[model samples]
Target: MAPKEKDDKPIKINKWEGAAVKNALDDAVKEVLTKKFNYVENFALMDGRLVICGIAVGVAMFALVWDYLYPFPQSRPILIFSVTTYFIMMGILTLYTTYKEKGIFAVCIQKDSSKKENVWEASSYLPKYDDKYNLILALIDGKTRQRRETSIKKSVANYIDVNGSVVNELVEAEVTKMHNSLLSERKEK
Candidate 1:
């Protein structure tokens, strides 16, 4: 016999707990491994550049100031300003790349009802299973590269179904793997 049908009512998804977050990440992963190499590519380049440039600029700024016989402390505003600006510039570059690679990232990060509604609506069609797999995979992918969680959420949101249990299970299996990975990662850190 078939499993009892779950009501069409959208489950109250507490993103902070249980399999919801993991499943979401899994679903995006399915897409990432399949349709979104560009997203990953852009992220890798953007992040790698951000980290490298951030450190380089920070070092150069300190070196430039250190060489100066200025009557200011090392933590003076000017020195701080220079370094801060470099970080800001890096942040903007990251944002631009992120926005270009993954449209409307702001929606997923917001805490408002509208954001939740939109995320759910956008993901309404992608049932528990497939979405679970794709999302879990994507989140894991992002974590490996130091990606923001919301980016994974946005990617997961893009590929959703209303109710596909079997696919959700496949996705769930992957999600479980991601969860295990995450726990181990935390332990390692």
Candidate 2:
């Protein structure tokens, strides 16, 4: 008997199924991000930095005006101190914000609505950490909104790891549950 050739054809899925899969993958990624990595999408740090900058600017302006009006040696020192304080605060804010932003790990799975392609485009932004596997995964959708979720188990396993191992068991379970629920919903409709 002749050896059977493996089929290399891609599976054809409708737009509805593709959307469902994309949604499930997105949800799974969000779960992994929040549960395993403990990443929350909050602007508290940025807001705090802005508030501090405002205070520094106000102090510097007050010192400058005081020195201009009083013209005293003591007031000059206060002006210098306020100006120096503002610069130092700005430098610290820049450095800390850059460090924190670079440390964030992110992943995105988007469907190209412009094109009629069925493939869901996936991309990941992993932080450069000392450990290769210690990464935080965040899934962003087409709208560019940062959705806090878990990692994609099978759909994005290759993107996360080269060994094809499941990223997280919890993520895998969640993905399976979502997929099953989606399928059941489709059957009921």
Candidate 3:
């Protein structure tokens, strides 16, 4: 049976029951950690070559529209100024956002002299997030283990205080249960 909270409380939480609570907390923490890693992965995606290309195209279109709608005193000077400014801003944004780059991008070019045809293919540039993902998972596991150990220690101490030497078997059983739970989790992985 779970130990009573005290004279003032109504319900009691035994060691086994406390495991359920800890399991829920563990799941929530794991979800949060996974979500953090997902956010990092999304950030990595945002700095891709495709996004840069899209930004360049968008800025060019905006410049064209601005020039068309409002004619400056000199068309050539205004166009040159806006285009240069846009490219400078794009370069700054790219530097700020894309700090790290991993993996190689391959481009293939094929030319036929007789047919006078050329084909160009480019590989996608995507960041590799496997290391970060694995590190996050390991952190989640470490945090979960730490939380469970502290909770079990507190429960065992309380049980000992309440029942003295008689609760030794219960403590042993609880330890065994914790060991089994960790083993099962490792097996799942």
Q: Pick the candidate with the highest TM-score.
A: 2
TM-score of each: 0.30, 0.34, 0.26
lDDT of each: 0.41, 0.46, 0.38
Where model 2 places Cα greater than 4 Å from the true spot, the runs are 1-41, 72-74, 103-189
Residue-by-residue lDDT tens digits, candidate 1, 82-115: 6677777777667765654342211121123232
> In candidate 1, what residue range of length 10 has the lowest lDDT sum?
115-124
Candidate 3's residue-wise lDDT over 1-189, tens digit each? 888754323223342333433332233232332332221112343346566766677777877887788776546676787688678868865675455332112111223335432221111121232111111111113222321111132332332333222233343354345444543654566
Question: Candidate 2 at 79: error in angstroms?
Answer: 1.5
- Cand. 3 Cα-lDDT: 0.38
Off by over 4 Å in 1: 1-43, 46-84, 87-91, 103-168, 172-189
Single out the weakest 10-residue window by summed lDDT for candidate 2.
Answer: 115-124
Give the total clashing residue pairs for model 2. Answer: 11
